[model samples]
Target: MFYSFIFILFFFNQVKTKSIVSINREANKIIKYVNNIPNNTWKAGFNFKSKQLKEIENIMGVLPINEKYTQSLEDLGFAIHHNSNNILDKDFNEIEVLPENFDASKQWSKCKSILSVKNQSNCGSCWALSTASVFSDRICIATNGSIDNNLSGEYLLSCCTGSCGRGCNGGHPEKAWKFIINNGICTGGDYGSNEGCQPYSIAPSAVELSFENTADTPECYHTCTNPHYTTPLQNDLYFASKVYTVKPKMKPIMYEIYKNGPVVAAMKTYEDFFHYKSGIYQYKTGSSKGDHAIKLIGWGEENGMLYWLAVNTWGTLWGMDGIFKIKRGSNECGIESRISGGLPKL
Candidate 1:
């Protein structure tokens, strides 16, 4: 009996030691990767000091969006809706002289919703959040900054039933826009803000250094969550007249933003992207984490390296106050590959 007990203790001790070694290796890998980055192009730091690799994976809010499954606006025959003329033809007259730096928030300073940096909380609803944010920004800009309202991400997260993809698990940006055009989204704000009809149901990850706990998608509801909000569900909705995808090129994207407004873009995010603190980000060392969606508000050059300024949905605690820049023009992480925006129905 004594020998059996001794053997059991020894086996457990070996397992514990291996677990500790594994954790140390993961943490050290992050530190070493950061230290070895050349030219100081960007800064990185840890949001979650995780003991396991899976913990880090759960913090990311975007899923692998399959382009094969989601249909584009062109596929839906929106080209004719714009009078059969190329969508780009209408806006290029003033875009001949592209500025070195452009910010949509500054261009339309009265459109306060353009500057919002929202927290998707523990939900992997970045697909819904970024699309909804861009939709909200366009509405304000379309109305000449007369209607500065936040459209509900929670509404899209729950109600986009078909091709919009699964809520919290991630959805297709194109489908989300389609839903906005067809059904129109209601007004909502961040968690507990009560500024809109339905605030976000999921709370943020709680702290900067902790692993994210996953959340189930909230139940779809048409009525406003706030009792004080007297607007009916039908009356509160905002619609889009037309939606279009930008050609995957630097100049076209620049002209699109300069003529219209900010755009929602999807990029292939890496493990090192989560550690981004400041400066222009180029994928350094790390394996593919998955895809992420972000709002591109502007572009500028830092240290002679051009970058697109983007807003992330991980709250102000992550990145540079929920903002980060990726190396632009080169299609870094496929950032420029898939971009979409629309005009609002005022």
Candidate 2:
């Protein structure tokens, strides 16, 4: 009896080394978390202490109500700020944007059912993709409602001008337009994966956006480059362009073609992004990695505050379907603050 009692006591006294907290969020506001800690230890929970929580709450006492969110992306482990609140309006036109012609879009017309960011499992390539997208959208709209101008992000990654513009670090969107114009764009399939680019360039047009390398050819992303259907006009980026609607849309000039997807924005870092829970934010700790990229698709205002709807390449399991509302023309995002979003002619 004495030996059994001693063993029981020791078992009960064992120390807990670790715990896991699983956070499940639904619809950007519903969060259900389960703490898997040692039976007696409340270990698997918030990283902040109770005092810290109270302090944080106090610091954010004036913040907007965002109970729907339980995660706070205080940083990408870097710099960024608080929460979200916005509406999805279908008041825009119904035209899909892509490069000229009926090749790729036509080929995959039956199979590709309007892909959203929720379905795309992209990594940190949000910048390249978004840059490509914006260019496409701008061109499509400029061309009297055309929808076939999808250039390849893979192509940009390989043959873009300057150094390392196409890596995990966010690529320059405004610069991307210039590069595309000089080089002309390529089909997404022309390049493969995050590595390896084999472009099949087409004859240079009067309105070429950017071009591939000398070794590579420029193919259409959607594979629809019929001369009769192809528009000679290329998409270019404009600096300081006014926000036309409630949300200034990210012009699609690249590989992916979604009405609502991620746009390349300047966040402060290149690490694990913590979930953001607060409704309003300014900035935070960490380096300006310039490595991480994102997408901006929609936007509007809440309580007279401006916000832009955007997408992160992380996963649909994050943000609002992998999307969030950022302060439009705010200093937090490097765009509006940096150079006043000035884009030079290509």
**lDDT value, candidate 2, whole model:** 0.33
User: What TM-score would each prediction reach against the true structure?
Assistant: 0.86, 0.42
The lDDT for every candidate, in the order shown, is 0.78, 0.33
- At residue 91, candidate 2 shows an lDDT of 20
Write the residue-wise lDDT of candidate 2 on 1-346 in tens digits. 9999999877665521111111111111111121221231111212222222211211110111132311221111211221011223342233344433222223334322112342112223444555554444444433433443354554554455343242322345434444554455543322222211222132211112211112131222433333333333233212212211112233221112232222345454311123343332233322233434454444455556665555544335444445555555454544332110111122
TM-score of 2: 0.42
In model 2, which range of ten residues has the least summed lDDT? 55-64
The number of the candidate with the highest lDDT is 1
**What's the CA error at residue 325 for candidate 2, in Å?**
0.2
